[model samples]
Target: MPLNIDFQQIFLHLFNFIILALGLYLLLYRPVVAFMDKRQAHYEELDRQAAEKDAAAQQKLDAYDARLKAADEEIQRRNADANRQLEAKRQERLQRAQEQADKLVEEARKAAERERAAMLEGAKKDIAEMVVSAAGKLADKEIDPAADRALYDRFLEEAQAAQEDRP
Candidate 1:
């Protein structure tokens, strides 16, 4: 009444505003807030599951790495063993070859000595015959068998003495 305003209308409008605010809070704001909370909880659960999966994946990777390292070590060890075996085999083969060569050389030496002995025996027989023929020609007679043997023995002894004196 002081400024030509109606106090009853103003009071009624204020009451209507209060009712509208309460209705909006119950119908729209409350549901929206609940939905946001549920969404946040869902996202948090998803993140936790993802973290668990990552941890499991890392554990599996570590296991694979360990196995791979072990495999590599095993391979190296096997390779070393194989190399040692190969070296041993090579040494054995070399030793066998050397022994074989020595045996062959010794056999050749023995064969040569035997051949030399046989040749010397043949030469002695030939020299004896030649000396006997020459003595028969010089005597100009058919000699007795015992005398021929004695002459041959004397000639061989003289030839051996001459050879020893030479050089």
Candidate 2:
């Protein structure tokens, strides 16, 4: 409105503002942007490393799990084998014990039978001798050992009758 209010001063102020803007862009803005870009790149690299570490850890864990599973299976197999062996041993022991018991029982039975047969044979011989002595006493004479054996057989009938009368 004043026409002479100093146009040169206005132009100089605009030039100074443009120069200030250029200086700020070159010195502060670009450096700040570059520093921010570098920081972002560093963070990206760290993130990638972290991802790689996580993947490696996961792989190790998987391997450990596989090994544990295999160990468990092996242990189970060994236990089963041991159990089978124990059962077999138990059965074998039982069989041996049974065989020994059977053998002992058979031997005892045979010994008892032999003892019974011997007792019966001795009793028969004693009866025969008693019959001969009794017949000799009844006849009031000494008997010839070999000649009266047939006559002594008659006493066996009387002995059997006496046994039948006993309760």
Model 1 misplacement above 4 A: 1-14, 141-167
Mind giving the per-residue lDDT tens digits that candidate 2 earns over 1-167?
A: 38767878999999999999999999999999999999999999999999999999999999999999999999999999999999999999999999999999999999999987876786687678776778667688556765466555656676676556543
The candidate 1 region of ten consecutive residues with least summed lDDT is 158-167
Give per-residue lDDT, candidate 1, residue 5: 85
lDDT of 2 at 109: 99
lDDT of 1 by residue, 1-167 (tens): 87868989899999999999999999999999999999999999999999999999999999999999999999999999999999999999999999999999999999988877876776687677767776666589576888778776877787677556543
Q: What is the Å distance of residue 81 in model 2 from its true position?
A: 1.1
What would the TM-score be for candidate 2 when compared with the true structure?
A: 0.73
- Deviation in angstroms for 39 in model 1? 2.2
